[model samples]
Target: MNKLPYIFSLVVLLSTSFGPSSAQAQERRGWSPQAKGAVIGAGSGAVLGAVINKRNRAVGGVVGGVAGGAVGYGVGKHIDNKQKERARIAAANRAAAARNAEYRRSLARRNARQTVAPTRLQPAAMPGNSLVAGSAAMAYDAQGNPVPYASNAAYLPNDAYGDASHPYSTSEYRRKSW
Candidate 1:
C-alpha cells in the first residue's frame, strides 16, 4: 500500500522535526540575561501549563508562557541595572584614585624643584662687609622662621638713590669713605 509508506514517512518526519536536539541543550553564549530568562520562563511555564490543564492544553500553554516570560524578563532587567550601577561606582572610585596619585606626584616634583641647600651667611661675607645695625634679610629658612644676622656697623643710606656710573662720586661712597 502506497498510503502505508506515506503514513510511515509522515510519522518519521514529525517525530524528528519536533524532537529535542543537542543544539537546544547547549547554552547560548551571546544571549543576554533577560533573553535567557524569558526563554527559560516560557519553556517551563508551557510545560507546567500543559500538565495542569487537561482540556485546552494549547490555550493554557500560551497564556502561561506569556505571563511567565514577562515576569522573568522584569526580574532579569532589574539584575542587569544593579550590575551596571555597581560597575559605574567602581570605575569612578578608580578614576578618583588615579587623579589623587597624580596630584601627589606633582606636589613631590614641585617641592623637589623648590628645595634649596643651606647656606651660612655672615656679616663679613655681606656685600658691604657688614649688615645694617638693625636690618635683616627678607629670606626665610625651610620651616619659615626668621634668621637674623646682626652687626655693630653703622646704618647705610638707601642704595636705590646711588648712580651706577658714579659709585665713587656719591657722598655715601666717595673716595676714602667707608
Candidate 2:
C-alpha cells in the first residue's frame, strides 16, 4: 500500500507549474508567492492528512492537499497586490521629489537675476592723471563682473572732471593740485 507515487502526482497537479511547456520565459520570474505557498501547503497538508486519517490515507492526502493549496494561493495573491501598490506609491513620490528639486533650481536662478546687479568698477581714467582718484584714475575692468558705465568717461569725485558747479569744486578743479 505504498501511496508515495500517488501523493507525489497529486502534489504536482495542484502546483502552479507542472512542467516547462513554452519556449519564452514567464513574465514574473522565479517562484511567485502563490506558487511557493501552494507547494509548501501541499507538502504539509499531505503529511498531516496521512497522519490523521488512519484508514484511506491516500484519499485524505489528496483532498487535504487540494484544499491547502487553494488557501495558500489566496494568501499569496493578497501579498502580491500589496507589494505592487507599494511600488506604485514609491514611484509617485520619486516623481514628486524630482519636480520639487527642479522648481527650487528655477527659483534660485530667477532670484539671482533680480537681486544681483552688475557691479561698477573703479572710476574711469582722465588724461594728464590730474585725478588719480582710485588710480589716474585709470579704472580696471570689473574682473569677471560686468561694468555698467562707459569705459572712456572719467568718473571723478567732487565733479573734478565733469560739472564744475559741484558743492565741493573750486575753479582749480581740473588743475593738478598734487
Candidate 3:
C-alpha cells in the first residue's frame, strides 16, 4: 500500500543520515593516546580557526593544532635539558669554590707559622722565672737542694717596694722631672 512505500522511504532516509555518524564513531573508537590527543587538538584548533576565518577553517585548525603540539613538546624538552645543564654547572662551581676555600685555609696556616716566632729553649739551671728548659742543680729549696723545674713556668716578679699596706701603689714607670 501507499503507507508501506512511505515507511520504506523513511527507513532509507534515516539510514543515509545515521550511516556516516556510525562510521565516524567507529573511526574514533580505540584510538591510541597520541592519536586521540592529536584529534582533540585538531578539533580545538579547527574551532578556533573557524572563529578566525570564514574559509578553510577545518584545514587551518588541523595545521595549527599539530604545530602547537609539536612546538610545545620541543620547547618542554629544551627547557628540561637547559635546567639539567644549569644544575651541572652550579655543582661544578660549588665544588671549585670548596676547593679554593680549602687551599686558602692551608695557605693561611703556613703563612702564620712562618710569620710567628718559635718558643726558645734554654738550660734548665737558669730557671730564674724565665722560659728556660733543662735546668741543672738550679732552683734551691730551703735546705739548699737543687730541684728540677718545669720547662714553662709562670714568671713571678718580686715587688721589692710593695708591702701588705700598699698593695696597689707599685708603678713600673719613672716619674718625669719638670
Candidate 4:
C-alpha cells in the first residue's frame, strides 16, 4: 500500500516535468535538438536510476536526471550553434556569388559597348544656294537627316537682333516687364 503512493507520486512528478517540453515540441515546426536531447536524457536517466538504486528510486532518479539534463543541454547547444554558424556562412557565400554574377554582367555590357562603333553626327543637307557656317552649326534627326535652323537670322554672326548679351537686347529688356 505504501508503494502505491510512491508510484503515483513518481508518475505525477515525471508527467509534470515533461508536460511543458512536450507541448513546446508539438507547437514547433520541427523538433529542436535541445528538446530531443532533454527527452532522451530524462528517459535514460530514469531507467538508469531505477536499475542502479532499487531501494531509493526517487532520489536516484532526481540526481541522475539533473546530471543528464546538464550534459544534454551542453551538447545540444553546441550543435545548434554550429548549425547556425554554417547557415550564416552559406548565406554569405550565396550573396557573394550573386554580387559576382552582377559584376560579370556589368563587365560584359561595358565590353559590348566598347566593341561597337560610335555613331557620328551627320552633315546638314543645306540647299545649294544657302550658306552655312560649318558642320559645327549642324544638327541631325534620328535617321541622320539634317535639321534646318528655325531662322537664318539667328545664326548670323554680327546681327544685332541675335546678340542677346548686348545691353539693349530685347531679351534683357523684356524680362523687366515680368
Candidate closer to the true structure by TM-score (higher is better), 3 or 4: 4
| Alpha carbon lDDT at 59, candidate 3 | 63
Mind giving the per-residue lDDT tens digits that candidate 3 earns over 1-178? 8479659967997998576664664546564445545555555665676677667665676577776566555555666678789999999999999999999999999998865433333334354655544543345454545433433334233343455454343742222222
2 or 4, greater by TM-score: 4
| Overall local distance difference test of candidate 3 | 0.59
Q: 2 or 3, which is superior by TM-score?
A: 2
Q: Cα lDDT for residue 69, model 2?
A: 84
lDDT of 1 by residue, 62-116 (tens): 8888888887888778888998999999999999999999999999999989967
Worst 10 residues of 3 by lDDT: 169-178
Query: TM-score for every candidate vs. truth?
Result: 0.50, 0.51, 0.32, 0.52
Error of 2 at 31 (Å): 1.2
In order, the Cα lDDT scores of the candidates are: 0.70, 0.66, 0.59, 0.67
Q: For residues 1-178, could you state the per-residue lDDT of candidate 4 as single tens digits?
A: 8789889987998998776674664545876788777767877886687678889887788778777777777777888999999999999999999999999999999998865443455444554434445443455555566554432223323334457676445442222211
TM-score result, candidate 4: 0.52
Name the candidate that leads on TM-score: 4
* Candidate 3 Cα outliers beyond 4 Å, as residue runs: 1-62, 113-178
lDDT of 2 by residue, 11-107 (tens): 8867735655574565646878888888888878877887788898877887888887887888888888899999999999999999999999999
By lDDT, the best candidate is: 1
